[model samples]
Target chain A: MYKNILLAADGSNNALRAANEAIKIASLSNESVIDIVYVADYEKTKEDVLHASSADELMIERRKKIQNVEKALKDNNVSYKVTILHGLPGPEIIKYANERKMDIVVIGSRGLNSLQEMVIGSVSHKVMKRVYCPVLIVK
Target chain B: MQSLKQQWFGNVRGDILSGIVVALALIPEAIAFSIIAGVDPMVGLYASFCVAVIIAFVGGRPGMISAATGAMALLMVPLVRDHGVEYLLAATILTGIIQILFGIFKVAKIMKFIPNAVMIGFVNALAILIFMAQVPHFIGISNMTYVFVAITLVIVYTLPRFVKAIPAPLVALVILTAVAMFSGFELRTIGDLGNITQSLPSFLIPNVPFNFETLQIILPYSLALAIVGLLESLLTAQIVDDMTGTASNKNKEARGQGIANVVTGFFGGMAACAMIGQSVINIKSGGRGRLSSLVAGSFLMFLIIVLGDLVVKIPMSVLVGIMIMVSIGTFDWSSFKYLAKAPRTDAIVMLATVIIVVYTHDLSIGVLAGVLLSAIFFVVKISTLKVERKNSHYIVKGQLFFASTDGFIDYFKSTDINEKEITIDFSNSRIWDDSGVAALSKVKDMLRDEGIEAKVIGLDTSSQKVVQQLDGISSSH
Candidate 1:
């Protein structure tokens, strides 16, 4: 049932938990694929650039963060693929999942929740409803 | 009649047309909301009256009419259903009293905290929910029938092209009603539930026995009403402010709303809030002064007294049509589309709000979800806003506020982990508020936690002076 699992990482503790769970699930399955996705919310690059330190420098820093995740996967002895996508994190993850026909998705339950989540929306809830495959949201 | 220009009726041309437009719109909404709130439709009407009259006079923003809205209406359902109508009214009155206190205390400052992203998400989610909710009405079916879906789709696609200033929902209502009524097409109508009351509202409250259990039961409903009322009124004030290039006195409006709800409760009415449709209609028409809303309220009373039978005669189909149009107009589709292209957090927040609102029965849950999502977006958004490191120390000038604190932390922590000693060059920084102080304190804590040495420079002593002081204090050669 857990052939191809997608682990969502937002550099948050919960996402790491979900990642760990995905790795454990993969290890248990023995014949499964693990994929890590980090979505860089770069939609406001132009606005952020005006007040930001520097775009090139930020990208370098972001790449390094992703590389760290890659290193973590390597250390865990998990054969994994990492995708650093620039788009809405939830939708992008869902889109990637649907496109790949991933069997399951794991994410942190408490990733980046704020007051705006009350009136605005949450990514995990949206994915839980929209996605066809099973999704595990870990607190 | 008074002087030539002082006719009690005001300008009949635009006002009457706008009134009819507003009436057409309000009637169905009032009815739907009454059912949603689990109260007699008359309560909704009465609420619409009280809110319109009171806010018209005391409201901060002109062209912003207050009324019994679906958001507030839905909250009443559990209250009326669980505690009976009498207790619900008592809670409403208490809510009003609280609102007045909010006004006196000037609690409008809270509105500022409502982030723009959350606001947009809220409006967008409301738009989708309202649009979907009206599908059955648009297609000329009322009982969640499948036939209405095709009709709604066809009408949604084709009607806007043919219709102009006359709202499409009205057209849909007329056509559908004609098809249903004249052609004897099988469908449901408000007439099916019960006869539309032909009698005017008498000043009376049901004498159902009340208890603390009842009050406790209605607590959630009142809180829900308060949140919905606050959100709706503030949002409407914002819209009116945008339209008229005016600013809103939020605290005053909240107090005003509170007063209106209390009065409404006393009068056997449900919760009331600022009505976006009526306000826009008021502006689009010749409603210039508080008189417009006052007249709207008085007009409802007058109609109930003199033309109750005629009002009851107005087809539910017509009201449904007006609502369908309103639902369509209320939706911020373009922004919904734009949110798709926004930051992942924002997009996620918006989508989650829409889903929760659509699926859940409780309105507060959706709002709570949206707010939490927005907070996350704010944090992440602020985190991405970075500080530049100039020289050996990090120099950050400008307002070192809470909004930019995350970015500062991210930059400082990442940099300090690599650098041995660092100074936050804040001498040139303009500390706007205590939020800056809080951020600085946080940075201090983070440095201590990470076992790195960090200090604030250029405060009482200039950066150069601080360097000199440090050099003078150094015991090592």
Candidate 2:
């Protein structure tokens, strides 16, 4: 029965599953609202700026990365808003979660950057270690 | 703000440990860069201590280490050799003033103009330069020196496999210095470079006349130092930002560097900037805040007070060995594959950057040449004005800028037009400048001479405005 929920999504299939899980938990409360937190990592932003031909194209690409989670919220008639954060995904998500004092943080077990995760521990794992709220990591 | 507290103290234990490691590594380098600049070794050490501490509070990039660096040292050689240390101090002050102006004007925005090819070349050049400077101590030194260098290299490269807590370079330094001392090895040491004074650097103006003649003497050198220092610092800041997965206020870092240099000049020290090699060491050792840099500066002084005697005895061979490891780590070895797979133009830019810097011993000039060559290539590629002919419709299908205007005329002049009337349509392209409009009118006149009427059509609003304004004046010509 969480009133304040943070859904960390990146439009991947795992993120879609996590979004569904967040929606199920939010339905149990009368005034529950969800915040969809999408983190655009600094390295990813650098690569994208280099590759994209125009600023508008970069914005469109970024929007596409979190489109699925937004679609899920709209279809469920859920009261939700999307917030874009920048930096390392794990630390940025945790900082936002702590600052907002969320009741729970629902995140995917796996992310889009598998190679990077292999090198540096996974984002969800880092979030579970540091975030001040309950973390529900859906596989 | 509460964020300031988080930035300084959020990771205290990790910061302190990493700072100590950086302090240990900074010792050999500060001494070596002083020898390169032809100044007393204490000058470089003083600058490193002052800059690192000041930038910890004033700089925009958290966790980045600034110090007396080889690039800045290379630039100071002529000034220090020609006028003396006092004049060099005056130049350092002027350099700081110029850099503050650059920061206020927000020079960080220009960083985007430096392409990735140039950056790769700059990095490779730096690594090569670092390696090259160690050659004198590396070869023909002595048989004993060789053994110590080999052992230091081994310990630096292989120790991380068994040890993760302490930095490899620190271990190499401590263990090799101990063995060299006890074994009675008669080898080159840091003391041969210069003496490291135990007392703190006192504040005093350089003993130089404050006049127009003095300004004239130091201005050129000061300008060179300012530009080179800012370029290296901003580039280093960008690298640290990428490594730490954060963004930095590059303009603020510029101003902070100015503050550091200004204070350093007054305190009998040379100008300095951020060091990429030490920064990578900082990051690898888990440093991620202002406290790390503050501790690095403080502990460097602390080490000199307590261990100054032993630090001067550090065998040059051991430092050379550690530097070799640093150079190997600094180079982007994957760039070998990058040369074969990347575009020929980019590859050429990268190579030109390396060759010019290595040959001229000037980082700014090489970077300038690379940027100019890349820009030339970019201009040539973007000047393609595809003029298509479908029946009597001549469609200009690319940007009609100054660079493309010559090609615009050449396309029509070389072709044989057998139509009585033809339409030159700007439906697909926009006219950008006066040269484009003049070319259009010139082509119209040339066609008119052949008894053919050409009508221009399909101009976008802005392009139409440009053409209409320049059309009558240029057609009269």
Candidate 3:
């Protein structure tokens, strides 16, 4: 049923699972295009920039995570485009999805552990609450 | 050494100008604080001069000003009221000794434990306390005094918008003081508050008797002063460090403050600490070196010696107006706007801290209460951890720290499966500390006693390493 699928990846096993699910769903349609997005959270990056000596090191670390998702998509032979955005993950993802008129958003249930997710609510939960399109949160 | 000299004198002209600006701002504040502590205005002035000069050389953070602050002044009131300036001097000495000990013990590292909520609460509480201190001058004062205060406030707030080069408070003080003098009103000038000794501060040991009784009297106040002084100083240093994009030696700062206070006490100055408002003013005015602070101290003394008569004639209402502006500027208004949207626990902690601080007039107690409450809330939240049971597997999510260990074990204990092989998945959870390892051991022991086979699985590399080091197991199911 989905045409433009947005897969939000953070390189976690859960995010990989969501990526796999998105790839499977997209395989059924010939015209469907998948966009794998990774949000380098602005606040987290700012904190890392402050605490870490080198900004390049933090950027490299984030690049590694994005590369992992890219490699997974390449290995699966999925035809997809990857975009990395810098901002809060939830709002940025939702905004991008709405602006791009995404048919469905596939995301991991949690990127950080449950305790942190409980304390600062999971990005997926926020995206699910606010996104206009259908959301498939992979556990 | 050459690099150090270059660094120190990098911005000589800018530092000198900023130092002069900071010095001018420091005068009325120092005098007002001395009055607040129930001592001669010279005592506060001398303390400001001594601490500023000393900290300029030895303070951990460069580009930050250290001087007599309202927080330290508030603390000295009870001390000066109960046992006179002699005993207060003794307490000041003792406070310095304790702060030195704190530095040697590396107590500044504990500052990281203080939550953002508590810090915000502290800033707001101090602002409220400062504003309240000015209330007496407004209430029951003469009509002309009221008019002068209004004009002073007006000048303080509006003058800055028009002219950024001149410090608004100094202008307001000068204008209002001249107006009060010309109008021939029976107003309460700085002279009315306390005598301003024209002579420079002299070195003298405190004359309090050194005995057990004296120690008992001064110990509590000294401890309070030492802690409050260090807290404010170190916090202000952190703020300046952030503003300047530089790291400060917090331990060194603590020790420097201790040394400054000790020297201040010996020189007949009341206890002093870092003033955040003045530090910001210094930085905003382009101060970037120790020379700025040194010049600030030297210029303050120069003003006291040369313009002592003019300083004495400044109206108390003008200082009150400046302080009110300081109080308003110090408060974090963002906390109020964010209260509804912030996490409930954080909001409660901040509010509780503000209320307790305002009511008790004790910043330390309020912060302590907030930290205690935050810890309790953390435990309560973590204790709600649950384990989901499936066929031959149990999924453990949430934190596996000390607070949630008992709850985690209890969940597995209630299960009546006997002699069954079970796998526990921990991919969704994390082991924060050694307590988590102990919890895993306890669970394994309990499961062994019930004749059940337990396999722990899905540990991340770090958690796996910790488990391997403790339990001597490498592979998980």
Most accurate candidate by DockQ: 2
Off by over 4 Å in 1: A1-139, B1-17, B131-182, B205-210, B301-321, B376-477
Model 2 ranges off by over 4 Å: A1-139, B1-17, B209-217, B242-247, B280-288, B341-343, B378-384, B390-393, B455-458, B470-477
Q: What is the TM-score of chain A alone in each candidate?
A: 0.81, 0.93, 0.86
Estimate, for each residue in B1-477, the C-alpha lDDT of model 2 and write its tens digit.
Answer: 127888799889989999988998898778778877889888988999999999999998889999998888877887888899999899888898988888999987787788878877877887788788788887997898888889988998788767867778878888888887888879888888778788788999999999999999999888878877887788777667656656788899999999889999999889999987788678768898999999999898888777778878888898888878867766767678779998999999989999998887777788889999999989887888899999999999899989899889998899899999999999999999988888899999999989889999999999989987875597635
| Candidate no. 3 TM-score | 0.73
lDDT of 3 by residue, B1-477 (tens): 124575479889989999999999999889888877889889899999999999988888777888888887877777788889998888888888998899999998877677667777777888898888888887788887788778888998888767878899999988878877898888888888787777878999999888999999988888878887887887777666645555678998999999999999899988888988898888778887889999999999999999999898988888888888888877877767658876899889889988998898777678789889888887788766778878878898898888888888888878787547889899888887778888888888788778887898999988877776766542222
Worst 10 residues of 2 chain B by lDDT: B238-247
Report the Cα RMSD per candidate.
19.1, 5.3, 12.6
CA lDDT of each prediction against the hidden true structure: 0.64, 0.85, 0.82
The model with the greatest TM-score is 2
Models ranked on TM-score: 2, 3, 1
Ranking by DockQ: 2, 3, 1
Better of 2 and 3 by DockQ: 2
Scored by TM against the true chain B, the candidates give: 0.73, 0.90, 0.89
What lDDT, from 0 to 1, does candidate 2 have? 0.85
